[model samples]
Target: MTTLVRGRGWARTHPLAVDAVLASAVLVCMVVGSFAEPNGEHGPTWGTRTPDAPSLVLMTLGALALVFRRRAPWSVLAATCAASIVELLTGQPRAPVVMCAVIALFTVAARTDRSTTWRIGLVTMTGLTGVAMLSGGPLPWYAQENLGIFAWTGMAAAAGDAVRSRRAFVDAIRERAERAERTREEEARRRVAEERLRIARDLHDVVAHHIALVNVQAGVAAHVMDKRPDQAKEALSHVRDASRSALNELRATVGLLRQTGDPEAPTEPAPGLHRLDELVDTFRNAGLPVEVALGQVGLDLAAAVDLAAFRIIQEALTNVQKHAGPAAKAEVSVVRVGPNVEVTVIDDGPGDDKGDEQRDVEQHTGGGHGLIGMRERVTALGGSCSAGPRYGGGFRVHAILPVTTAKGGTA
Candidate 1:
């Protein structure tokens, strides 16, 4: 099998040489057939006759024409057919020169279209049989030789057409398999990119919010450490609480990536709107008065929608506490009406005076993904989000999350 594979590879690389080999094979078969007389004594007799000079020349000429069959199938077929006609008409004892024409006809049929093959094959078969019948030898018009020519030529055309059809079918199947493989690879890459973006958003939301609180409390402790020990100790305690909360959230976020059998994996469910009061108390402890209005009560929101609502509120209040001046107040409201839940956060404080007002991709300069993360989360759920400076003053973020998400589930 390996040797056959190697020979096939060589034949493909040297197609002209393969054609030459086929021509040689056809020549040998014609020469051997010419020495046998089928109508002689017993049914068929070998080595009973030798081809005459003209018959030998016609046979050689027809075989040589096949060497160029692949390059010019029609031209070679015409030459071989002409040689066969000459042997049939003039040669005293005919040689089987038509063998070369049969091979050439097969090549023509395989290379050309079916309509061309049928027309050309019919012409060759009828032309050769007519010439042999009209030759007026001792044998009658409807001899076995004439019938053999018609049958062989017809079969060659059919066989070549079959080969061509099978080759085209195999090629089409191969191309479709390759296309499907490429599509699968592209889909895998798209899913991986979406997963990476989600994990990064989670890390950013968890870290940025708690770190902002920790920064505020630590700064307060440093400011009053010398004069007010009790107040400084209280400030330090807030910092400690913020740090622990940050650790737990961080653990939760990172735990999503841990393998099932890994040790010390957190079993707690992810945070959602149920913890809105705790989120508010954290900011209030940092000296930012955040008032919450929850009109989405008793609404059985999807897990994803609930988590997004909680993060939107958390990030908005964090921005107010961090970027808005110390005396600023924030109001967070989540109201559900008519197949949608609207989350709005409005702050009376000036939002980073001389900062990013339009709230585009770059929300601020502190490496924070403030409005960017919020917009991405809302948009993924097929909802609309907007953040900009309110007409008079301050910043306002409003998002309408659909109760029924794009994935065909209610939030």
Candidate 2:
């Protein structure tokens, strides 16, 4: 029974074709009821109301209006209400007309705002109840039949409004869920982008220092080939060592670029501030004079922060070797300040002394990857770095990195 009522209700709520069928069905029922005899012989017979052709014509017109009730609900409601009032005034048995009015009210409430539905509903209820009570010959004002019309019309309007409210609420929840899903996807993309940038920075540091050392050693090997075979062999040996180290580091760094079908990247320690002395010794062996000063250090910094410190020093020395004159005296210093570590690399070399011969070397500096990588690493670990020339002499690279990560862990 409920399913049948719901199906009829769905037909009324939908568009033209279903509404047309519902209207036609209701019209057929009303026409059949008009011809058939009433169950109780106490009231006027259906044939009595249908005796006059004009009354039947008006009744048919009202019923036909139900075909467009879903499309033009207010118009349908007004028409059906007027038809019901006319039937009462003409002293005809109440036509099967209230069904169209009820369907029209339900359509209005479901499609319109709640306030409009309430106002329209109250007006419809009052008008229908008032007409049925006052336009009376046999029925009294306080009769059960009069009150029944009022109760059924009110139920139809309220029920339709309830269904409309539930639909709106469900739609709102679905919209919110969709918006949250989009936000989560965007956040995942952002994290992936940040991780890519970090890998690129690590790769930059690995390639720059190793390649510079290879170039310096290779140049030495070529310059002294005839003059000193023994010296040339040593330089060649250094070049080979640098190349091997570069390859291993390259293998570790480049492993990140592959998302699948690759071995896991090395989690082992890379050289940091503790390895500064070895780094300087390599440059010292390559013919550059280096001075190092290490402040009293007992601090344990974060792995990322230490790695960044190591890269800063490495890049500074590489820059000096490539840009500063061979006779340059480079000073490297690491100072432990409260909650921060400061590293400074200064070289007293003529800026114009190095070769403009290697275009690849010039392009490396022009790309700005070295400095950008340094800054990004420092900033990500909640620190800072700066590089420029000194007032009196040569270029200086200075960095101040935090000893702790953003979460207050030793970095």
Candidate 3:
């Protein structure tokens, strides 16, 4: 069975060679049938008594036309049918001349639509059978030979139409499979792009916050180096701590890109609302007096919500430190109200017209991306974030996140 399948595959790939082989076989049949006698004494007969030169030539021409059957099936069928009619009209003994016309008709039906098959098949069958019956030959009109021609032509048309239908079905299946594969590839690419953007936002928030603190501490250390050695030492220590925290967070953020088979990466849990105290302490050490107010309504927050709330607070404080004057103070508040956690950071800095415009220009001109990152994180979790200068004299950053997990479970 396997060998037969391989042979058919090879024949499809080399159509010209298969056609040549078929033409040769048909020629051999016609040549041998011409030499046989149409008598009951012989093993079998096709109503032919003796071979004639014109009949032999016509039979050879009809057999040779099968070579081009695939390329021009209608033309080949016409040529073979005309040759067979000529043999019939000349009153020559019957040979296998009509077999070539049957093969050509089948080729046409297999390659064309059903409507063309029905029309051409009817014409070929009726023409050949009518000629065989009406022409004056040694056989009678009601002979079995004429009936065999009609049956054979009808069966060939039916078989060829079946082959065409199967071929169309296989083609449709192959096209659908290819379309599905392309859709899967596109979906995978879209997911990869979203993940990369999320990682980029995390990296930006981590680097901007810690580096601002490092710059402030390093300046304090350089200023008090000679006059107050102890104070300078404390500031240098804070700088070192800030740099170390920055490196740790950067490593964690980049570890997401590591291959699964590589060495295991850091498993430290991400900073969340629970780490609010530590976060505030770091900002206080950087010389920003920040007060925290917490109000609770008893709701467990999801991990993503907890992380987003913490990062929002962190970024808001960082912006206050960078843009507000030296004497400015900030307040951090976290309140839970009916299935939601709201985080608000407000700074009592003199946000005058000049300061607001300066900060706006800096944010728009790429000097800051903290607020943008915060808003994106909040919005992804189906929350809302707003940041702007307060009406009186300070800046406010507010974000509200859902406390429920994404899987419809209470965290």
Candidate 4:
């Protein structure tokens, strides 16, 4: 790519050198034409010598300035115009010198403001025509030949300014197109960064909850190993199931990262409120007493709201299973609160006894980020959540979610 860019830069530079050569060739032809009568009626007179060397030298210098006109337009125009004035006063037809000056004028017009071009162009034409007519010995006041020189100079200046305007207008259009393309690329990058952040949040939420459950069950198996081997085996089985389920969900959540031609994604439906009964049955089979109370909310909420509510309850219950004692009983409730739906999970566990909730929170701070994740999800959807000890003797988690999702869908 670097080599290709360097090659293209060279290609763009070569054309300017070609243009300079062509302009010099045109000036040479104009000087040669002035040596004798263009109609061939008065060939070079032997007495006067064929068009003297001084006039030819001045015209060559004026054309030489054309080489730098694109890079330094104003300097080239001043040089060429000065040379043309010298040629006119020395009794030589100065048309070739004016050709180089006209080319430089067009370059300045295209590169600078119109006011500067107009002021300089008018001054050059008026001074050149005045010298051509009034400087020589007494002649007819309205000579046709002298008037033609004045008219042609004015037309040349106007034509050069027109070319300059067209080039500038084309350049302005190209610049706007490039700016619009850059803006589109910037927007695309911003969206990709946001998607990566969401994926990280989901991964953390899934891993923290399941791993904590596995740790709790593993501890149970170790404690009962000597007293009862059969109970230890059942706890180990639960631990294995929980780990495998976590891996599957994590793989599905990060499916967007898969490269092209990878295996097809899973077509199974994501777990939502409809799976509440089944989730509760799993706890019942694991020797945890759980009661679910589902109330009839007036409206059918959007899919994102339903999914967020289900995950909130699932994480809350998972916390109860890990921190609450094996014999603890949990009450899960879902109720309608005007335009929103509310989910509450309450547990009567040892962690709540003797007002040790604050101390337990401090001790388990490193392992439990579930409450933080739950709050983020709720708040992101324009809802609210609070988790703390209940009135009498338990820990309760309450969440209220809007009926319509923020962008109208789940992540």
Q: After superposition, how far is residue 306 of candidate 4 from its true place, in Å?
A: 2.8
- Residue range 46-143, candidate 3, lDDT tens digits: 54466788877887798788989988888999999999888777845677688888898899999999999989889888998999899847788877
In model 1, where is the ten-residue run with the lowest total lDDT?
A: 357-366
lDDT of 1 by residue, 1-411 (tens): 999999999999998998888888888988889888878866779888998888888888888888899899989998998898888888766789989889999999998789988998899889988898898498888778888988999999998888888888999999999999999999999988888888888888888889999999999999999999999999999999989998998898788788867877788888888899999999998999988889944457988788888898888887777666877899999998788888999988865653434342244432447677888899999999887667777778899888888888775
Query: Any runs in candidate 1 off by more than 4 Å, and if so which?
Result: 259-264, 297-299, 356-368
lDDT preference between candidates 2 and 4, better one = 2
Question: Per-residue alpha-carbon lDDT of model 4 for 1-411, expressed as tens digits?
Answer: 999998678757886785578567957775665654422336433223345677778777877777787777789888987887787777544344666666666667667767777787788778777876775444453454456556666666677677768878788889888888898898899888767755765776567667866787788799999999899998899889878978887988877688789997766666678888977765665666889988885435676687678788888887777667666789999887777789999998766442355425633573346776777779888999988766776678899988766887532
lDDT, model 3, position 145? 65
lDDT (Cα atoms) of all candidates against the true structure:
0.85, 0.77, 0.84, 0.72
Instruction: Tell me the lDDT of candidate 1.
Output: 0.85
Candidate 2's residue-wise lDDT over 1-411, tens digit each?
A: 999999878766676878677778877776666664343578635555453565566567777898887768889888887876776577355555666677778878888888988898898888888888897667688665467668877887898899899989999999999999999999999988998898787777778888888899899999999999999999999988888878888887776576776678876567677888888888887888899988865547677777778888888888888777777889989888998889898998765634322322433454467777877878888788777767786877888887878767773
Q: How far in Å is the alpha carbon of 238 misplaced in model 4?
A: 3.0
lDDT of 4: 0.72
Per-residue lDDT for 405 in model 4? 69
135: Cα error in model 3, Å: 4.0
Best by lDDT: 1
Q: Flag regions of model 4 displaced more than 4 Å.
A: 1-11, 14-23, 36-50, 125-188, 228-230, 254-256, 283-293, 297-300, 320-333, 336-339, 344-372, 379-400, 408-411
